[model samples]
Target: MPATAPDLDSRAAAVLGGGATHAARTYRPAIRVARARGSRKWLVDGRELVDYTMGHGALLLGHAPPEVVAAVRAQVEKGTHYGAASVVEVEWAERIVAAVDSVEQVRFTASGTEAAMLALRLARAATGRDRIAKFDGHFHGWYDAVSVELDGAGRPVPGAGVPASMAALTRVVRADDGDALATALSDQQVAAVVVEPSGAHYGRSPLQPGFMAEVRRRCDETGTLLVVDEVVTGFRVARGGMQELLGVRPDLSLFGKVMAGGLPGGAVGGRREVMELLSPADGHVVHPGTYNANPLTAAAGIATLDLIVDGEARAQADAYAERLEREWRCVLSDAGVAGRVWRLASIIHCALDDPDAQARLPGALRERGVDLLHTSGFCSTAHDERDLADTVAALAAAVRAAARVRR
Candidate 1:
């Protein structure tokens, strides 16, 4: 017989770090998912929970959409890896170039982190500058070069294991602060100005209107390449991601998540001149990865991109998120809780006025059979009227429970 949830948790604790695969997934009583489909997951202990994580923003169409599943299954029969270039990858690249205006060329990577690393390298190579500037609270992946941020004193603070010398190469500027951003780029020693066009942490604290355009102008003035990290926003927020919505073209854009159709893959797309830095004939940046644009990921990415080409899938997901956001606000108001819910397309973030209450909210929601990605929710096209009703019901219960605990 399969081990119970508690038994699995105990065994996991003995082997896994903090009994969780990812740090964000750690909970006091870890919930074990047996299987997930559509907007719901079944726990090992037989409890059914409404799922809002949605593959950490990868499943804009929801878990295992038939088209994507069929694509992967068909490709699996061909082979997972050809060990050489395949036609599917070219088709995938063509889809990205056609969708995103800023992306004239595309280079696939194993994950978003690799994409980020490659993008910075390209920026540095193209500009012949070593320093990189980034907005405060903008996450570009777990790489050492992009892991540094400002401390309370506004000094660069590198993450553990990141060298101080390496951190010095990254100039941290506050998001939406045009003066500080301008100052960061005025030196002209900065190769790239990397940003998340949706703002920091996927819009928990959104950029003010026109902030991205301002950043783009500054980058142009300083001869710095603008690298927009669209890993979370790509294809989920729109068919072309945030850059399309904002009408701001970047020199380079990083994409993952929805573009890969719930699979593990990412790409750096940008102007031909900058992206060609990876080409051996004209440039010297050589990137080699065994699984880069492997057959399986290419098939899934192609299928996902095909479905979202017309933008209807993005519209459906956004509409669902809009309803969920409204219902969340109504729940907070009804529960007499001090909190606010905001959204960026399909991603929803819930914040309580009381920090302690906010901290307890996730646990409370889980108890009511609603699972969120951290404190945010990722809506999908697969969510329907039933999911809407059940999610609102769960939020109502969870808010009341959190309020009682606060009292």
Candidate 2:
């Protein structure tokens, strides 16, 4: 097993940059998954680990969900690609439109990043403004426009490969700072004020109560389009995402992850007038992608959406997460570990008092046969009592291990 692991590791390093496709997927001691099903994944060495990543928040129904598998299987037999419009795609979009109140029209993209990019483009086109504003630490995607972060002075600092001039067009403000947000939008040159209603890092830094409503009001006052990046929250948080929970409507909403049923897909749904910018009649925003609403994705998405429409899946996941949150908080307290556990819907976040312990927590969990998405655990409807108990024990051990490590 060790011999095979090193060989495969070397091969991956040679072919795949960083030995992983996505940055988040990379691990300290690279893990190779052999297979997965229902809240657990087996490593190449045949080690089974409780999976909390849950397809990075896509698998609300859990891994290899039967309905999605059946749908994708049936679609593959019919056709993988038609090079034209698809009925499954239409149904998927219909479900999104019906589920989300703010989304009157929707357009699919290959990934969340692309969906975010499209939303910004549409906002700029619809408002005829060059500048955009986003809250600091609220990551929309990896695209140039949304890649910038704010420094300590609250100044916008663009990531590498972003032009200074392009960075100049963005305004960065704190998500909890309503006054700052108001001041940022006062100029009225901003096309869109994009945000994650749950705040940055999937509620690690949660929005203050009523912050979203205030954001909506500010956007309305300044005539700026509000784009909510719900890529991580859509479908997983609720049927309609954070906007529904917050009772605020945005001009544009981004969807991905759970909305795509663990497939590679994303979407921008928004007001009909603004979305019409992409229509042939308007020719305002042009979007083209090879895999936009591809049949496999649409099939999985449709099946996933159908199951979650009744809110049962979300309820189940949330219930499990609630238990996890309670138990984990107790674990930290009982173990005398300086950490706190919090949750937003089905997503659980564990923050250590020591920054180094926080950094080591995920790796420690992986070693204890549990995998997390950073310091967060994404619960699924499939997680049951056994998985919960095991995860709790693993978390307790991992916290102790992480806390013992010296800088």
Candidate 3:
């Protein structure tokens, strides 16, 4: 019997779909986490694991940090949300504006996906252009227009439920080469180019600094708006998000993840003149969300940002991630596993050189005593050398287990 999360999780799986609301939480052979504190999680069956997932990159300060939890508890006791304006909402806006580079004005949304949809709409209204350019494999969100990709026929197909016309307006290109972007933007009707400054898939396929700079140059020359999607990398990357790390400013930016500190939230920010397109002065764009800045989420966001800036948490996360990546690589290598590790700040992804390796990896990692972070791992201040060491050992053992299996 698995010695981890047996009590609460058995009940959770019986009632909850796959035992968790989020699909990522449900893994083969089961990994049941009962509760978390600081950077550690306690299983219902009494096993403990270092919490590297860190709320899917949302907990910059680590799991249930005392400062953040206290802020949340204080707010919860008062009330979870007011359904009306509050000082906390105002504080959230001010903190976001101060932290991000391209943002001079900002608006909140329920999730990062909503922010991406809003940014695309505002770009069309502002420029009066219909077409948009986005890189291949960069996830903007679950939104309609951004969800499209080229089908087997080499024709772009709308993601199910998205208006087909919206898909038609999107131009897809590879993220590897910046020069290809110049050719696409030659269109006068192109309203904007939306990019994830981290390259793609939360930096799984990263872009070189020069490639991003080149894209910026082309957008400026063509008079096309540049929208940088920072939902995963926003506050998690640095105080200013990827904009500060890349040193390139976008016309518009989408932020989420760590900003909410485990609560649901999103924000769209950029220059005042450009963001003004969403208001009465232009009468071209309007963005309204009933739960945009719910007091609960704002309270959480303010506390998260305050910790990020004051404690220099981003640097600390990066330092820890570097060591974690190196240790895992060595372990997997010594085990004669063909897998390799990739990282951006604290986000680490391990993929095998073998095309089929990933499908089996998530299962094998769980067999060893530690809960695998699906295909990737996150590093936080709450994790120590032992946690890092254990994860590396898990990777090594998991790889060996897979090696013994025949296709």
Candidate 4:
């Protein structure tokens, strides 16, 4: 095996600027994926890898899932985008409504970011409030208004390009601090609270039992609306996303990733009266998109839900997660590597907590025939015990290789 990866740098730089189409994948070098199928991806340089990225949490059923592919193939023949309404869209919403306890009305978007933005708009319009509050580690879409702060020096620093004025309208609070949330809500200027119920993306933060209940209590006590961002946690976490698992209903919820079965699709679902504001008939808010409810996405989304509704696959994935999460921790410990295995059900994050850590994990893992998912790994329905054991060993070896490099 070559110590230095091949064609990754030049090819990426030549075509994709900064070596990637998306900022996250760019890293410093580049990550080139050739093709994927069933829990794995083959790299362009001829390396086969156990893929934990899985379309960045989109492939709940795993790569090129049979049902999802069939749905896409069938829909493509009927034509991809009509820029018009279709029955597939209606059925997609119906499935979402049935699965989630809080959703009565729904709107589709091209990405989860858009769904969240729309959710915020509707919340503000309906509540007649100007400010939106969210936990520190949670990331909503990249929209300027909501994307305006990062926890710097234990205080909010205005995110670049976010007007200092608009910065004042957005409030940043700790995900665990119920008192701070209450204060923001009491301001009466807060329109909504958007949260990732499991706190997966925010440092893999774990919400203490009843933390969600506290949030629900706070929202009800004040006039604030709650928006749960389920882009990463939607189907994979559980059938109805974190809301169902936690038993605390929010006023609005955003869905993406696994919801599309690995296609480009997103949605905002919530109570009827609030969502009614999005209807053009009502003089409140607006929701529009070129790819909104396109037949291809709708078909793919419907197929994805069909596979998730029964919760059998979810159970399998969660079981695998428990096994792998524990095994990885053990392996890392045995290797004398310093890190912690942080997980939320099937979602596993290996935080490299060591100060001496100096190697890039994606490169090290790729060299060992396994794909890296931003320091985390998700177990798919297709990953059985065999895959889990193999991955744990692979990660153990990769950590040794990484630890060998001179800082």
Candidate lDDT scores, in order, read 0.91, 0.91, 0.80, 0.80
Best by TM-score: 1
Which pairs clash (backbone N, Cα, C closer than 3 Å) in model 3? 5-44, 5-45
Report residue 216 deviation for candidate 3 (angstroms): 1.3
lDDT by residue (tens digit), candidate 1, 221-320: 9999999999999888877889999999999999998888888999999999888888887559999999899889999999999998998988898899
Between 1 and 3, whose lDDT is larger?
1
* Tens-digit lDDT string for candidate 4 (103-198): 898899999889888888989898999898887767777876667555656576667787878878888887788998899888688899888888
Please provide the root mean square deviation of candidate 4 (C-alpha atoms, Å): 2.9
Question: What TM-score do all the candidates reach, one by one?
Answer: 0.98, 0.97, 0.90, 0.93
Off by over 4 Å in 3: 1-20, 23-27, 44-47, 151-154, 281-284, 405-407
3 against 4, candidate with superior TM-score: 4
Worst 10 residues of 1 by lDDT: 398-407
lDDT of 3 by residue, 1-407 (tens): 65444566677778987678775766545666678887778876676776667777777777877777778888988887676778888888899898886899988899999999888888888788988988888888888779877666646667778897778889887785666688788876778899998988788888875888888889898888999998888888777888888999999999888898789999889989888877776475777788898877888888888888764687888888898888878877687777778898889888887766677777777666555467777777777777777777777777777666432
- Ranked by TM-score, the better of candidates 2 and 3 is 2
Instruction: Tell me the RMSD of model 2 versus the true structure.
Output: 1.8
- Please estimate how well model 4 matches the true structure, expressed as its whole-model Cα lDDT: 0.80
lDDT (Cα) of model 1? 0.91
lDDT measured at residue 154 in model 1 versus the true structure, 0 to 100: 89
Off-target runs (Cα >4 Å) in candidate 2 are 1-3, 405-407
